[model samples]
Target: MPSSTSRRTVIKTGAVFLALGVTSCTGVPAPSPSSPSTSTPSAGDGPSAAFTFGTASQPLGLDPALSSDVESYRITRQILEGLVGVDQTTGKPTPLLATEWTESDEGRSYTFKLRSGVIFHDGTPFNADAVCANFNRWFAFPAALRQQAPGSSFKGVFKAHSDEASLSIFKSCTAVSADTVRIDLTQRFTAFLQALTLPAFAMASPAALAAGTADVLNQVRGGQPLSAFATNPVGTGPFSLGTWDDASVTLVSNKDYWGERGQIATINFLTYDHPQTRLQALLDGKIDGFDAVTVGNFDQLVKRGMQIVQRDPFSVMYVGINQEVPVLQDVKVRQAIEMAIDKDTLIRKFFIDNTAQASQFVPPKISGFNNEAPSLGHDPAKAKTYLEESGYNGEELKFYYPLNATRPYLPTPEKVYAEISRQLTAVGLNIKPVPVDWSDGYLQKVQSPGDHALHLLGWNGAYADADNFVGPLFGEKNGEFGYQDPQVFSKINRARSMPQGQERDEQYHTINVQIAASVPAVPIAFPISALALSDRVANYPASPVLNEVFTKVQLKP
Candidate 1:
């Protein structure tokens, strides 16, 4: 995860596009005019062509505000437009529908100038009023919606403006001008600009949202509406929903899109529950791309002529110790457990070379990463001594691990947990392994912390920020770990308050040091993502952000 300043610098440096090579992949020989071609047709062609792709799982919803998962956000990216959009070449936020923006000195008030002549998929005009109406619906949802909605990941993060008479009618946030809106925050946030790049901030046209005489956007709150427009989305994006077959979704290109017309005129997204089936489909040329490649078949795919794209995703795979448990409450015991395991050996055996051994909770890709922090290296003798000192006798401990086959970008969770259990038994600790299905197990563990003595878990960074790495894990009232440190919170708060400069850097450095000393979550390894793509697909870029923008993709002849 990169800091705001680092992200800005990266954007200014233009290294992202240079490293990836932004030139469109063309020049391939076109097939015969009468032959079947995978590429979509242009406007010149009497009937535009469509492209199809495959994924491991189905998307949860089409509504941008209701989406939180990767698949849902990927689909939302095609149907919604935000004020600022992420650059495909770089992860930095750039002006999109909004032509320009200005911020007050205090950074509390921001005004945006909307681009002219934008229309929704339903032929509705998109303007400042539309933006306000969309935000109003989003801000109206309660905290419970986070669990109910498909993409309500950051539901409680922002508080809308309250006084409607003094300001705008769009919930808590107010609109100042026809093309400008003023967003007043409850507190100063350094990552607000980056947050705006997320799908939750997408703009929706009021006319389109209210077209069917049903409150589709507000249906999650239990309103008396039998018909909702969310199922049939209306947006100013490149694609419009065509057919939803429960197992697959079809999208057609929006002819009236305001920007450069997309190369592909249509897209068919097919979802499969099993990774093996998806991989087989990709290899057989039945689909263009698939994710969550299994470790066993990764090498086989490469041998069979498949393109593998790798990236360091923002996830920390670690063993969470139940601090409330009497055996794990002691700091010495925790340190002993950390030292007992050989992380490097585990990485070498279970993961490829690309997977890095983690010494701290935050991955090295994140900004303000502390390379010099003291790490707990493998030393079984020291671990034994600490265990003896803590008066640990032979006692049995039950460890819970999910039996999920596909967990975002990881392999089978049960296999990883079994290896861990074997390693723990090698030491004096008596271990019992319990495997449960992912869906029920994941919800139970996250909702009720400390359900097990130790469990395997992962965390993905919401944005490229150190605050994202720290605030959610250790902050009071957040995560399963109820650990609170005023000094740590103060340091993070200082970093958030300071402008982009040396002071902010110094504050982050302090927070990192504090976190290293007080290990709330033990960092194990930063795994690398492996994506399988067919030769027909072109211009796919690898990114840590994990955003999906396939409009530029062109299929082969």
Candidate 2:
């Protein structure tokens, strides 16, 4: 997922501001003036049993391996199953397709016992061979394809760089028998099991793969305009793809699902980029609920009797500086950029009460979070001093921000960018604000190396492990920041290889502090993720790892 930095985007216009109560983006009211009716639920003629929610961004496609954004993951989770599932309440790996597993070869190999008597939606048996096939396909994804298409977000989890001292822990996956699969790792990686819990590693139907439809990721990378799998997807989960269009995507319950059938017959996600429009829709009862809810409208939504569910802060919203940029190459300049913004003020102006200012990339709950890292002071004088110390010439710093999608951490990106731009300007920096469409162009550009000078990005955790935070963005050279710190990389590798405990946590904490001092990105704030639901909705599913299982959700009347 765009870090919740890979998670998503959001926007602006004078008329939009006016509808949002004429308040600035940071202070704007979320709901439209027109109030929704407080009608009671009736047995008949009430809302459909189908649960309808809104997505702030449209998913790129339904192919899990090809998808890299939170929106795509949202849909993917409903349609697919990973070998391991996350326990929502405890944030630990739970059983899924693979009922149990054993670690051997000194933590270098894992043997999984597949769940028996399961079939894909297409009637093909799911077995050890299917698991191997999926692994083979992932391993075979051409390196060149990463450049052509939005590459697989799970690439790092599966493979390691050849040139670096880093060893590829994933050596091979083999089917030892019909009910068992053995995976050999080149080395021990403590986070390997946790990484398997990501949706990107979810087990897709091998029948779909054999039938040629599951090759959407590969085909799109070769320059196909669009992939068929995006609209028509086949999976063994509790829900199957129903209808997919530009406006909405629907999922119908899988009656023949291996596990308990979904209580709700249908799961519909309406694509609404604008927060006000989504809020109005909720108020009018046109939809049941929505995610990435605007905090500014929380009171109004509560007054309207909407049920609000919140997750502890798990994502980090930050200002990513491209180190390759000439102006940002100097450490002093990067530190100066970090000092320019007043994160406390921004958090107070935009986020919910629970949201806390961040000093490191990882949130407080993560094992490796550096609680003692010194927070950068909001000192324009010091910022100017650093700029002068760098002996820098005034250059137009291209500041990029996404325009039409919002994540839990970044509810109002345009407003956030405006404030950030204002802060930078006050520090005597030449900044050029560039707004790009969230899907049309923003994501690809920001994730590509050297395409940005400075960008506003956030990352929602896919798993609870510290590796989830440090490995993706800084393990090697990441596309977003283009940062390549050898010390940071070494520590990340060492931490991942060690078993989960205080020792491992200490290693990660050390790494985070070193990273904080390096200033790869300005750690901003960890915003609390929230969901708004209508009264009829019940047993709503959510996880700090961002997992939401639809099978358990129910609707009243």
* Candidate number achieving the greatest TM-score relative to the actual structure: 2
Clashes of each: 8, 15
Tens-digit lDDT string for candidate 1 (1-557): 22234222211222353233212111112122232321334556522656677765555456666545466567777888788765556455566777666666466656677767788887877777787787776665554444344235343234222332232212245677776666655455666666677776777667766774323345431121122565667788878888876578888878777665556778888876676787888878788887666665565675676776655556667777666656776777777777777887766655534578877666675565677766778888887888889856756666777653354435556667777777676667777776755533343454344546677776655456666666556543333444557788667655654565556656776777777666665677877655777877665655565556666665566
The estimated TM-scores of all candidates read 0.79, 0.88
Candidate 2, which segments miss by more than 4 Å at Cα? 1-48, 159-166, 213-226
- Estimate, for each residue in 221-280, the C-alpha lDDT of model 2 and write its tens digit: 212224455456666787888887778889887766666664577889998898888888
Weakest lDDT window of 10 consecutive positions for candidate 2: 20-29
| TM-score, candidate number 2 | 0.88
Residue pairs whose backbone atoms clash in candidate 1: 1-366, 66-151, 67-151, 68-150, 68-151, 160-172, 161-172, 161-173
